[model samples]
Target: GRQGSRSVPQIIDDWGDYGAGVGQVAASRMAYRYAWSTTLDLE
Candidate 1:
């Protein structure tokens, strides 16, 4: 599954509002890393 065009905010928004729990924080970190990696690959 390639989501290379999505920004971090867009990814988070897609996940919907799940409140700020530990899992949400971890997921955000993972999404941020995924987005960063995808951006690097695009370059």
Candidate 2:
């Protein structure tokens, strides 16, 4: 479902790098969207 056995901080650290490599605003928006969608789907 998610990534490896990393904590939330670790995950966000990776996300920051990935986001920076891509596009900061876009990557952050997408990450938030994905997180919200996943939570809604789970519910």
Candidate 3:
């Protein structure tokens, strides 16, 4: 088992907790999924 690890900036960057207004969440989610799928040859 590996111990968890994260610096403050790294944690904040991954958390995305700051206010995301409008369609930000959907847009970000779509972008992430699209990029991931394409990179993995799923799309």
**Candidate of highest lDDT:** 2
Candidate 3: minimum summed lDDT over ten consecutive residues — where? 14-23
lDDT of 1 by residue, 1-43 (tens): 4755767897797666655566789999999999999999999
Tens-digit per-residue lDDT, 1-43, candidate 3: 2478667887786566544543688898899999998999953
| TM, every model | 0.53, 0.47, 0.45
What local lDDT score does residue 1 receive in model 3, on the 0 to 100 scale? 25
Best by TM-score: 1
lDDT of 2 by residue, 1-43 (tens): 3555778898899999987877978888999999999999999
User: Best to worst by TM-score, what's the order?
Assistant: 1, 2, 3
In candidate 1 the C-alpha lDDT for residue 13 amounts to: 74
lDDT of every model, 2 decimals = 0.82, 0.88, 0.74
| Candidate 3 clash pair list | none
**Model 1 misplaced regions, further than 4 Å:** 1-20
